[model samples]
Target: MSENNNPPEEKKRPEGITNSYRERLKALKQARQYSVAGDIPKAVERYSTYLYALASYFGVTEDKLSPSFFDTEKEISELLLISHAYWDLSKAYDRSPNLHKESIRCLDQFVKFTNGFKYQHINAQMLKKFIKRKQAHNMKAFQNAYTKIQVDSKGCFIASYSYGPEHTVTNDLRKFKQAIVNYRLGFRFVEVYYNTSPAIINFLEKSGIFGCLLNKVFIRPTLLLISKSARHL
Candidate 1:
């Protein structure tokens, strides 16, 4: 008999795990494409599929795939991806009417999985505060608080912190934002400011003296310039 010359066949991944991984990849691809296309509902559907498949690939149920079940040191990347998916899902739910409770649940999961990571554009701690405030108040109260948060998140962190939410200076800053936000450059500046200012304000608030100093040295001076500019507009 002729000696066998062919190499042994490579071992295949378990069928279930292989299928789960393939589904996860497919769902993730569809989710991102739908998101980029601004088909939020479709994106949300695909994201849900991705999450389920990810859990299956990891040999766990979706709820059991949280940080509590995973080894954080070994699986930080996986946890972060899960956190990001939850965050995106939360944002999608927020845009849908009658899904506030679902949005809050997804935000809670995002916060849980994002324990050590810091994101500039989305303040997870601030989002937790909003969630707590929403649960403790009536719908109207929650709406007002949510509106204030949305406004504050735009670019008025220091102004809102120093002068109070209703202060004339804060109102003036908001009006200035409205005036300039119509222009492309102005909008981009506000976008950058919004992404960066929250962390600065968070730090300042934690240190009282620094907050005071910043208000006097930077915020007040900027407010003065804004006031002067308002006269010209």
Candidate 2:
């Protein structure tokens, strides 16, 4: 018989983990392509997908995919992947017009992951501090805009209708609305909402039971989201 010279096969990851890793890699590749092509929104979408896949690959929820949650002794590769994903995603979000808060969050995650690394370039910690200061400045701007809005102006008609106009919830929703209007396309959206919401509010007011049902189904969840997002801020 002829002597066999074939090398032994390499060990493989389990099928599910391998598939998840492939999905994460594919998303990262697409994100990079979009970033290079100057399609930042698309890049952000793909990077988010990559993060979701990365979380799945590690069998953790997306919120729990941070470095502090991983076991460094056994998951160095996972930690490295998470670090690079956060870094790239932060860069992508930084370029997005409406994603300032998300950009800061991603950068924070990147800084956390890279804290102990010996690579001397980038100075992510310093960059984060600078970005945070800029964010504080932006928040002040948002506050100024909020103050400019007339108190009588029906803010977030749906929210105002659901939670009485003078309620703290309504005021919080107004603040959120002001933040949205500070973004690039946000003013146009507000215009559209202003034009259409009066009629919707009228109808909701007329249909008392239906409006109550809708509030329970819609407004409650929105309030929950707002509460969570406020905590992040």
Candidate 3:
């Protein structure tokens, strides 16, 4: 009998990388369900856990991981720009004692990334301002300050504040801060429009459309409110 000369077949090893996005997405979906079900703590846990796994897969710290990790081009896309979906998980941490630090950490990483692009500059600045606002003021009070000014699309200004019977000096300060936030919101809106569509804004401005927008009668009263609030602050 002739000896067999064929070499034994070598079994192939599995690829080192697995796309875990499906699993991450499943976790996110579960989180949303839990959130809708009013199980907020579980939802936060699920989202934070998924974020940790995703960051580990990318070999980045959780705070540094970005949506670009999931992008084929590994660069900016409309998903990252228009959606801001990454902040969802981070904001979830806001309600948890242990997770709130992680929330700020993640926001810090995003703020750092924004420095690389001019379009994100205002967002980065605003994020930093938000962080400062969180640190310098009580969170509940800060939130109160955020809710005072309501500007409708029709250019109407609806302002509400509680000076209260005590009227302590701190109340005045709080009112001032709220006024500043309201003032910044207007500037921020314009910045967002310019950042989102610079070419269109430029065309509009050159055609005098932007001037017409700025000329709205309601704007004068809004500025006056800001002026009064600044003085009080």
How far is each candidate from the true structure, as Cα RMSD in Å?
Answer: 15.3, 18.9, 16.6
Q: How many collisions per candidate?
A: 0, 0, 0
Candidate 3 per-residue lDDT over residues 44-138, each given as its tens digit: 77776666655666667766676465442433442233123344445566656766666555444444344323335345345446656665222
lDDT per residue for candidate 1 within 1-233, as digits (tens), equals 01222212345656766666655756777898998999999999988987887676556876666777656665566566677688678777876568877776776666566543334245444554656666432244334333333333434666667776677777777777777766778766666666677677788878788777977898878876785685566
Which candidate ranks first by lDDT, i.e. highest?
Answer: 1
Kindly provide the TM-score of model 1 when superposed on the true structure, using C-alpha atoms: 0.45
Candidate 2, residue 54: the lDDT equals 58
Error of 3 at 138 (Å): 6.1
Worst 10 residues of 1 by lDDT: 1-10
Give Cα-based local distance difference scores for all models. Answer: 0.64, 0.58, 0.45
What are the per-residue Cα lDDT tens digits for candidate 2 across 149-233? 3222335566667766677776676666666666657655654655566666677778889977877898667875784575444
Task: Report the C-alpha displacement of residue 124, candidate 2, in angstroms.
Answer: 3.7
The residue pairs found clashing in candidate 2 are none
Candidate 1, backbone clash total: 0
